[model samples]
Target: MNTLEQLRAGALSGARRLTLRADLRELPEEVYTLADSLEELDLSGNALDDLPADLPRLHRLRVIFCSNNRFARLPEVLGRCKSLEMVGFKANHISDVPAAALPPRLRWLILTDNRIEALPDELGRRARLQKVALAGNRLTALPATMAGCERLELLRISANQFEGLPDWLLTLPRLTWLAHGGNPFSAAQEAEALDNAPMPRVNWADLQVQALLGEGASGHIHRAARADGTAVALKVFKGEVTSDGLPGTELAACLQAGAHPHLIPATGRLSGHPGGADGLLMPLIPPRFRTLAGPPSLASCTRDVYDPALQMAPGAALRLATGMADALAHLHARALTHGDFYAHNMLHDGDGEGRLGDFGAASFLASVPPQQAARLKALDVRALGCLLEELGPRCAQHADAVQVLADACLAAAVDTRPAAHDVAQRLRRLALPCG
Candidate 1:
């Protein structure tokens, strides 16, 4: 019963961004009539099968979220919105996504949890496209033209029918994040085999346990050195730490997959320790823990490490920060989130380089609630901010670098925070700024 004039006035007077998911079953005529001035719109979690045809008239619109709907076809009007950059149609009934249907300037397109069988060649040819989330679909193959998307960084196609990943996708110059594990079209056989793989045997006597590196409510970390003189950090997890077995497994998997130069890669697992405890063996970081002075406080070790002044050259600080950023980006690209990202968990190799050391809290986006996942990201951002603050006056010398770090740490909201890849890019730029 709402009038167009009333709706238009309400939209104009109210918030420029409108979310009309509640108390609405169908697209009200008044809603579309007021679209001209709208900059952002979210109609997700609704029962609509199709969008209002007049959506293209919203020349100023930038973001549109229609996920969790009943739409079976691509919205034809989207191509007309010149200003449109982000479109989220996840959890919809969409089966086909016409390449030409998307706007040229579209930067983010999320079609996860849909019926999409394949993407149009032109979809990947768009130069401005940066992120695409198409997980939980039926895609058997990716368009070859996707190679043309020079700026694309994230491509998530998990839970699909792929037998093998597209070679081109693996070779993407800018594509850093890729998650296609669950797809039958990719390496399903390998992944399945890994799930049932036997655990490696461990000889406790052969491994010399050094000083206690860290401790948590659920586990304790010790610096262990093998007889061969190979040193590694051993994270011994108490059996009763978490009721959920999947998170623990995922944490181990992510660390194992990550072998970056600056990342504390997981070497293998260690089970059947004293008291029937389980643990993981990772590369031993340098003895000098730059983030902390002596040992961490009970509170700090239980949570995360936060140290401000370790006193290092400006170049060393820059290298450490940049390396950490790169490692985080690598994890993010894999659609994995380090739920516990803090200074204590990060270890500096003493050569001005750093590595992400803990994976006990890592998880995949599809496995965790979006809201909860967002909170984890927010925590990481807060930690990043705290780390910058701890850097103190040294940060002032590199104002531009510090600004980028600050922005990543102090974004208005979790969703607004820069992606790990973007954070790494900003760090790289700030590392070498013009006078």
Candidate 2:
């Protein structure tokens, strides 16, 4: 949290990265002093509405975060930064993104919670692009030119006005994760899911948070006790759009997913926060469980990183795969897609007792045409295939059946992958492992 005072005092002279959260409305002149050394600059949570031409003078800058501001336009000066590759302007009022503002080296872009009605055609010209977070925008359709983003992998277009997903999106060659809930097409279906759910809704004041359990891109989880003294894990959502989508939509998906033995036991959402913040209540995860793998780093981009020394036996791997497959099938039955399905969203007891959680990136599939729905579900199959592929090296030898099934799940032709129900059934019929 470097301050203007610290920068002016020359205390941060050699810093490579800088972050300032002191209600700045404009760029500080002192910031240019370290342009030669700065690679990242974070001025998020400020009152800024615009950027200065001098901002581009930070020639070595590779990343910039100006979220939670009042900007109505993306500064054109950004287009001049030679080294800039990652840009985040989350929660801003930005409605205009000039084609000239995007750097050629750009790989990641986040514009969640903005008023963007349309994206420039040049967006597709950035062939190096990989991750794009465009949730909560006004976009009715993506520029057709984006079909050329062959290197693209993860995308979040949730809470937008798209009536149908672009057909070319499924053929992007590398797209794996997608979140598209809370849009006009899915509004009625999402409403139906919420209304039909038998989830218990509790008043906010009835709960008392005891300790923080964890936090994610969208919310904070805590260990809490209800008015009746029942122990529960509470997830209080941040009141804004996230890299995934809206918090309310996530809460609804969690409620609609209902119960599955292989899924975290969620009770449902609670109402009546003093500030009207939405929250989800669930049976506390047991201490024996832990996340299966670490989240992706900047270099790995979208792939989860696992422990290099970790190992698994064939039987254990089979058990884990079966459990996850069952959970997916359960969600499939509910017409929901766990778009963010990954090792980072999984928990295990290290003995094959695993649970699938996190609906922040989940979406409803009932609103799309059957062809689109098939594509959505097939995307999940690819995710499952990725999970199974990770299980391969963990064992002394790849289970032939698992490997073959993985190959089928990962069929380059999106529609060729088997459905989740069939995958689960097949996993059950596999012979007992040698271990």
Candidate 3:
């Protein structure tokens, strides 16, 4: 068979998968002949709107990619594909989805950059459904039936009309991840009484200020302790503001998002300080120098600077990378962008584990101006690339593992760079091989 004939022959046969992307606006009838055995298909970046009715005959089909299409509605035939597990319809024009058009086995659904205003109540009935990405849509409210999705773990409903989070949503046992603050329906209470109220005085009797840890452009950090002897970090704001107004407020918001196992936790906000202004209370971190002055390098940390025994080793580096990936995943899942993501902003928890810190530049994705968002994401990618460069030589013995991470960091296109969740998955996979 010639090249075209060979491709056509494969489509006609009982192939388990197919990925045809050569100026095909519509699926040829010949493609349906293998429906029974086809388990995966990729017809993305095409002009197809609806699927052939025979597509439901693909009983073994598990995944489908129909993104970047012109579909106004979901193809009803998908409901018959009982084995369908995932569907990627991002960057489409889909405005509505009939509950009956979805398969019960569907688990991961990606409908980003669509015009969907609402979902049917039956959407929450899918027992196995776990992750749902609905960013860049027009959702006004989530169906209350969503509470029935007991297995749902990650949800991204940012840029919607939610004024407040659904009460039932907050109670879901498996709903550990959420990012929906942009919607009008999800508006949180503002920082009230700030203007009339006097600045809160720091309870010095309840806390002890220690030595200065470091100084940033906007603030100075000090190691501090509570009256009960609990250790914490104190960040006193500088009197002058940079081009951005009130950097302290932004920092406070990032900290209020709370601490992840892989993120340094901010304890509380403190006012009335030695600098004559408000400051932040955070967890105290032992001083550990990172390779920021030059290309990514891991120099031997001296005992006087920080406990040499606590320094990160090869195994520890792998673990720290994995943990940091998860932390980034959490932030990304919530549509929160960490403007700066270098090693300088990450803190080791004394046992090789690490947590993301310094959210002074962090912002909700939708809240950031479009041009600024692009710049921030690009900067983050550069930082990640630098990190990979640092890890590459140290992990030279595991070339393939190192390359995988480096490649993710160095993806040519900003949009093509792996998301935090994808990075975490890759890191986990690399860890197994490196070990």
Candidate 4:
């Protein structure tokens, strides 16, 4: 939220990253002064409809975010920036995406909540592409050319018009995280999910909201007390389409997931919100609980990050893995895929006890054909494999056994990957020996 006055005053001369949110109608001319050092730019929350044709003058720029703006099309100048790799234009009216608008080195592209109906074949030509967010758009089909992006690991195509998924999408060797719910093909199943969940309505009047606990991409969480004086965590949706999908779609998926020991126990559905916002009620996490790991970095692209010095006993490592495996199995039994299955979503105490949270990227599996569902399941297993690999050497002992299971989850043949139930069962067996 830096003011334009500071930028224009040359106060940020040596800044490598600049963010200005002053309702700018166009790129500030002062930005060019930092062309030699600027590496990132954030011009979100403005009224901008376009970027200058010579925006590439920022030769050192590598990332740019222009979300919540008025662009009707992606700026073609973006492709000309030789160092640019990350581009975000979420929540715009963008429809046409010219082939010339995709940079050759593009790795991460965020075009969520737009009106795009088709993607240029050139999108596939970016060999470095890894993460793509295209949810909340009008896309009916994806270009077949995208099959060549061998390094792609994460994709979000939910809440779009897609009638079905393509075969190549399932076989992507590196694609471990995905979401495709709330589309034409899955709308009926989404409705079924909303209707079939046995959730209780928790009236907003029954609770007293307290201090904010945390905020995420789609909502704010607050600590609250129920009518019975019991503490609970209340998550109120922002009621907007996020890069992952609609908040309402995510809320439905969580209700459908029900309750499990390894999952954050969602006790009731939030109702009678004065603001008309969708939300959920769950047991409040204690202060001792914290995220097991951090989300991906610009360099990691799709992998969660753990402390380099992180070390655990053989039993602790096995216990953590087993609990997560149990959560994954529970989710799959209900035909749900936790699309963003990373350590960052796993909350744990100092010990091995943990629960998987965050349904923002979860997708229903009931709608996809059996073959496609199988592939998606394999994708889930691959995510588990990555987690296992991430924690492999961190275990003081039994690292070999952990990697053995990881290799099985990461098997190249989709159909050959072990089922979620089997993975959980195997982990339970592995933990018994270490204990």
Candidate 5:
């Protein structure tokens, strides 16, 4: 939130990061003064449709955010910045991505809530690309060349116009977290889940909403109490498109998830909001429980950010891993994929248990062909492998077995990866030594 006055007065001189949101129509010339040191620039909520042609002067810039702006296309100058790796232009009017707009070293790109109908073929040229957020767009097809991006891991293609998924997309060796809900091909499956589960509906009038627990792109969660004197957590979904897809799609997935020891059970669906907002009612997570880690940051892109001081006892880590494995296996068995399977999506009960939550990115797998469903399951195995690898160093006793499983899960050959059920069974067998 550094202001133009601060820049003009040189008060923010040598600053490594800068964010401006004063309805800027153009980037002030003074901003270039700190080019020698600036590495991150956030110019969201502005009216600017283009960047300074000389933006490449910021030689150290590695990340830039221009969300909520008037840009109709991705700025071409960004491609000239050699150090740039992450770019965000969410909530803009961007309808085109020029071939020269992609930087060579690009690793993560966010174009959510835009009008992008197609992508440049050059996207596949970036070997380091790992995460891409293209949800809520107008994409009918993806560039065939993207299959060359072997390092890609996380992708959000939900809420788009694709008639079907690209076949090459399923073969990416490193892809794990993938969300394709809200597409034409997925609509039937989503509707089927809702029809089959038929979650009990709890009218909003029967509940007393309390303090807000947390909020994200899709909705606000609140501590609530039922008229029958039952305490619950109510998630009032924001009736808008999320980075992944529609909220109703998420609710259907949650309903279909049913009950698993390691899953956050949905007690009922929120019905009859005065304003017609949809919601879900579930058991309140115990106060002692907390998210295992923070969601991915700009720098981490697709990886969860753990507390540097956080360490889990081997028993605790094993317990948490086994719980997540069981939850995921149950999900896949139901022909569902918890598209966002990061540790951040799991809640850790201080003792040893972990509960998988957040169906915002979940998608149905039953509709896909049998072979592709198996491939999708293998993709999720890679996600579990990534999670285990992240929690491995924290384990004290069963570190070897955890590492072995993680490595196998991350095998370059997707078919070589173990199934979620197999991994869960193996994890259950490891009798971790008590502290």
Candidate 6:
């Protein structure tokens, strides 16, 4: 946090990044002194409604964050920042985004937890756009022009007012992660699933909370035990508008997932949190298990990062890939899309055995036409391809077969990618290592 006094005194004259969170109502003119060097700025938790048109004077600015503010409209001057690539306005009162408010060089845009109902057509014109977050808004429909955003990958339109899914969204070649729960279409599908197969319910008081295991954008997972002294992993959702979608949507997907050998099954649903939050009781993962890789960092916006020294035998690599493909095939069979399919979401025991988890970005398939649903399945194939690409180089055995499978999975033509079930079968046919 850069103090206002330091800024005014020119102590931060040539700073490359500046963060001001002193409930600022306006930016001091002195900030302009660093125009030549400033590249990132964070003005979150402030009271600003607009920005100075001269903001463009910061010729090298590339990222800006103004979350938790009082802005009712996106600052139009932002579009004038020629080098801006990332913009975030989370948890604001923004209700309008002018046609010219988007930066041409934008790659990542986050407007989570806002009051916006629509987006400007100009959004589609940015050829470099990739990641987008519009969850927890009042949107009724998406701009048709967004069909041109061919480079778009991750998208979150959950907790909105949409009555149907659009066809163009299904055809985007690079779209991997998509969350659309809390909308009318999704709500109806969830209701039907609950009516057919409800999850077992467990009261909160019956579980003894122990230590926290991990936390994510959606909720916290804890190591807990039942009143009967049975150990379990408990996930207590934040029960709010997460960047991906609503916690309720994730819970619904969990119930519908049923059981699979490579999936962390939900044994029961949590009924009571003192604060009335949604939660799940899952089988306890082994203490020896750990994440295979880390989630993408801001620098590697859409790719997972792994340890460079990590290596695997051909058989071990094949085993891991087979399990993931089988799990994904199961999800698609149940009309569910594991939107956020990445290595970081998998927990491994170091012997090529692991389970897929995290449904925060999952989407429940409903009334889409068969053709479109098949294309959506192909998108998941691409995600699996990406994971295989990461693992192939490290394997010494069956490298040729793994390369062939990866090539087919990543084919540009959606129809060219093999179905997950077929890939799993092929993997199973490969020779296994001796015990």
State which candidate has the highest TM-score. Answer: 5
- Number of backbone clashes in candidate 5: 0
Native-referenced Cα lDDT, model 5 = 0.89
Clashes of 1: 10
lDDT at 165, model 2:
84
lDDT of 6 by residue, 1-435 (tens): 899999988899889999998988887788899999999999999999889989999999999999999999999999999999999999999999997899989999999999999999899899998999999999999888999998988888989898877888877878777777888877877777656666888999999999998898889999999989999999999978889888878888888899998998999889878999889999999877788899986678788999887655446777888899999999999998888889999988777788999988777776456787788788888899888888776556667888888888888777779999998888777635511
Model 6's TM-score against the true structure: 0.94
Higher-TM-score candidate of 2 and 4: 4
Ranking by TM-score: 5, 4, 6, 2, 1, 3
Cα RMSD of predicted structure 6: 2.0
| lDDT, candidate 5, 1-435, per-residue tens | 788889999999999999998999998999899989999999999999999899999999999999999999899999999999999999999998998999989999999999999999999898999999999999998888999999999999989988887778999989999988888888999888777886889998899999999997789999999999899999999978788878878988998898998999998987899999988898998888889999998877888999887755447887788889999999998889999998898999656788998898888887688888888888889999999998776666678889999999999888789999999888888744442
Residue pairs with clashing backbones, model 6:
none
Residue pairs whose backbone atoms clash in candidate 1: 161-185, 162-184, 162-185, 162-186, 163-185, 163-186, 164-185, 177-333, 232-284, 305-344
Say what the RMSD of model 4 is.
Answer: 1.6
Candidate 2: worst-modelled 10 consecutive residues by lDDT: 392-401
* Better model by TM-score: candidate 2 vs candidate 5: 5
- Write down the lDDT of every candidate, Cα atoms only: 0.62, 0.86, 0.63, 0.88, 0.89, 0.87
TM per prediction: 0.53, 0.90, 0.50, 0.96, 0.97, 0.94
Residue pairs with backbone atoms closer than 3 Å in model 5 (clashes): none
lDDT of 2 by residue, 17-41 (tens): 9999888988889999998899999
In candidate 4, stretches whose alpha carbon ends up further than 4 angstroms from where it belongs are 308-314
- What are the runs in model 3 whose C-alpha is more than 4 Å off? 1-5, 11-14, 185-435
Query: What does candidate 1 score in Cα RMSD to the true structure?
Result: 13.7
Pairwise lDDT winner, candidates 1 and 4: 4
Model 1 Cα lDDT, one tens digit per residue, 1-435: 223355656634434576765645676666655555677888887787776666777777888888778889878778878888888897778997876679878888888777889788878767888777776688888888887777665566655776655545533444433444454432433344335444454667668888997776447889998779888888777643221122244334444345788776667667556676666677766567544333333223222334444566555665566677777677656545654455666767444567665554454544434554454444455445545554434544675667657656655444556656666677677666421
lDDT ranking from best candidate downward? 5, 4, 6, 2, 3, 1
The CA lDDT at 263 in model 5 is 95
Indicate the worst ten consecutive residues by lDDT in candidate 5: 426-435
